[model samples]
Every structure is written in C-alpha cells, then in structure tokens.
Target: MGIEAELITAADLPRLEQFDGLLIRDHTRIDNYTFAFAQRAAELGIALVDDPVSMQGCSSKLRQAKLFEAHGVPTPKTLVLTRETLPIVPALLGLPCVIKEPESSFSRGVHCVASEAELVELVTALLAHTPALIAQEFLPTGFDWRIGLVDRQAIFACRYHMVPGHWQVVRDAGTPEYCEGRTEAVALGDVPAAVLASARLAGDAIGDGFYGVDVKDLDERCVVIEVNDNPNVDAGHEDGVAGPELYEAVIGTIARRAFGAGR
Candidate 1:
C-alpha cells in the first residue's frame, strides 16, 4: 500500500476524482456535504469506508432502536417521545430515565431526567432542534463497552467510564468533559461471548464498515446502546494499544478495495 493520503476540505470536492479511494472522516448528515462526497465517490466508483448507507444508519438513534429490536439485539426499553406522547414517558420508561435527540452523538444531546417536570423541560428545549426525542429506561452502568469493529469484526475494546457525577460517558455541560478511564485493549477472543456477539450483530445491522459499537453489560446480560460510524481513533486514546495493527487493518481494507487487490 504505497498510496499517499492527503487531507482535503469541502473545497476539494471537485478534485476527488484524482483520488483512488475516499475515507470520509467528517460529521455526516444526509443534507450535508459529507453525504454529497459519498455520493460522488460512489458515482466515480471509488472505494469508501463509510458509504452513505452506513452513515445514515449510524447517524439516527431512532433508526438504531428500530434496528436493534428488529434484529433481536438486546437493548434497554426505548420509546419515541413526541408532543403527543411526551406526557406518558414516565409511565412508559419510568422516572430517572434518559432522553436523547434522534441524531445525537458524543453524548452531547443526551440528558438524564429524574422527574416528569424535568423531562418536559429538557424535551421541550431539545424539541426546538429536532422533531422527536427518545426516552429510555435508565440503566445505571458506571461504564460502557466501546467495541470497535471493522468489516464486521471486533478490532478494539475499551470501557468508557461515565464522567464522575454524570450519567453519560462524555459530559457536555457548560464545558465538555471526556472520560478519564484508560482504554484497555482486550483480545477479541477474551471479550465476553455475549458482548462480542451483540457487537457483531449491531455492527452488521448497520453494514460491513468501520463502527464503534457501544454496549452495556449488566451482570451477564449485555445490551447494545448504539453504533457509531467514523468512531474516534486518536493517537493516545483509542489507538493507545496496538496502534499500528489497528491502523493497518483499517487502511489495508481501504487500500485493497481501492487498488482492487482483493475483492
């Protein structure tokens, strides 16, 4: 793989034809330029890590909830909350539940509400941005399992501990705060069978591509939280252990697809 990769911006869309493959690393939305780039790459027959299908599938938590249920993947009880159904969320999911925007990521648009009044306030505020929201039964897991998958295989594993005094992995109050837990690389074979199976099932439900499957393990029961595309793989964080091998696996897939070395 002697291919040279260069970083390009939205301005480089016209020049994408010169590249052999396109690995979209931006926040993708159906109406955004990233989706346009994926479409362009598809039209040009260039290899893409996260094609539009994966992007759209992973971007919506609402869709993920449906997928998890349809695929028999275990997940906490969730319901789509609208202005009409907002009043019954407490009865449906109970107090101390979690509310999330449909397209939220990095735990930015998520909130833990303990009462009906609080839920209404948060949902009303968030509804200004999105049409509907998700209310889920609160599962008090101190940490969540982040299983990185490439081509439907688990490549890396870590526990994303919740921020101290917060309920989500990433805290985005007045100032955003991330987990201080060290990423521990667990061998695929060493991972819990149920967790690995659920991760694979969740990733496959989206597509065969790069994904970070978030899961919560309570006792021996494992449930899928969400599947994210273009997941973080920073130098010291996600790539702290077995950095080269992980990078090679992702790049090799892209290169092989681009060069047509193996189909």
Candidate 2:
C-alpha cells in the first residue's frame, strides 16, 4: 500500500482535490468541518472511509438507539429524555441508569446516575448543550467488548475493562487524571458466536464501513452498546496482539478503495 497520506486541516479543504480518496479520522459532527469535508469529498466523487451516511448514523445516540431497536439488535432499555421527560427516567428505566448527550464520545457527556436527585441535576446541566438526552438501563458489566469491523468484517476484538471502583471503562470522575483500562486483543474465532453475530448485525445496521461496535455480554446474551465510526487503531493499544495483520488489513482496504485494486 504505497498511498501517500497527509495530515490536513480546515485550511486545506481546497487541496483535497489532489487526493484520490479521503480517510476521515477526525471527530465528526453534523455542522462541523469534518462533515464539510465529507460533503466536499462526496461532491468530488472521492471514496471515503466513513461516508456521510455512516457519519450521521454514528453521531447521534438517539438515532442509533432507534436503529438498534428497529433492526433487532439487543440493547439496554433506553429512553429519550428532554427537560419535560427527564422526571420519568427513574420510573421508566429505574435508578442507577446512564444518561448520555446525543453526540458524546469517549465517555464524555456520559453520566451514571444512581439516584433521583443526581438524575435531575445532571439532566438539567446536560440539556444546556443538547436538546435531548438518552437514558438507558444500567447494565453493570465490569468490561465491554469492542469489535472492530472493516467493510462489515470483524478485523479485531478486545475486552475494555473498567477502572477499579468505576462504572464505565473510561472514568471521568471530576478529575483531569483519567483511568484507561487494559485492552486485550482476542482472536475473532475465539470470540463467542453470539457476540460476533451481534457485532455483525450492529455493523450492518450502521453501514458497510470501518466501525468499532461496542457491546456488553450479559448472561451469555450480547447487547449492543453503540457503533463508532472513527474507532481507535493506535500503534500499541488497539493493535497490540495482531498489530501487523490489523494494520495491513486496514491499509489494504484503504489502498483498494483509493486505487481501485480489487474492483
């Protein structure tokens, strides 16, 4: 894969015409510059890792939750909470539920509320930024399964364990010191059949593109947590065990798309 890749900024939007294909690794939002670049790439007929369709699907939690239910992907009980509907969350989903802003990523704007008082306060504060929030039943799993998918195929798997005395994998408990749990890469064949099946379903529901499907395994049942578009594929963390193969697969896909090798 002899693709010449370059790091670009918003100032280089006009220069994208020189590239055959674009790999969007930046954070995406509906009104952000990432989406602007995606729109421009589509207009230029350049292949993109996450097309605009998948970006819209992955950015909003409310949209993803509905897609999960409609597509029969198992997920924790979820509800859309606004200022008016926030009071009924504790009753509908019960105490110890998780609240999330629609566009939050990397555990930011996500909160685990254990009481009614906390729920009210957190929802009020979160609503200042977003119009609605997603409230889900607290599925207390010590770890979460991250299935990396490339073009609807399982490329990598890992168990993201939670920090000690924390409820989520990435702990943001009022301090700058964040705790990152251990990442153990597991072979795709070694993963449970149910989890793989669920991950496949989640990947298909989003679109046939590069994705990281987060799932929770409870009592042998696999529940989809969320689908991520720009998933982590760091040098050592995500690619620890199968670093070479994983990198090759990803770059191969990019190369094929850019140069039309397989087509």
lDDT of 1: 0.83
Query: Relative to the true structure, how large is the alpha-carbon lDDT of every model?
Result: 0.83, 0.86
Q: Tell me the tens digit of each residue's lDDT in model 1 across 193-219.
A: 888888999998999889999989887
Residue 96 lDDT, candidate 1, scale 0-100: 94
TM-score of each: 0.91, 0.92
Q: Which candidate comes out best when scored by TM-score? A: 2
| Candidate 2 lDDT, 1-263, residue by residue in tens | 57777888889898888888788888877878988898888888887787888889999999998888889998888898998898788888999999988988889878888999999988888888889999999998888999999888888999989888888888874578988877878877788888899999998999977899998989767899999997988777778777798877777777787768773
Q: Which parts of model 2 have CA positions greater than 4 angstroms off?
A: 173-175, 261-263
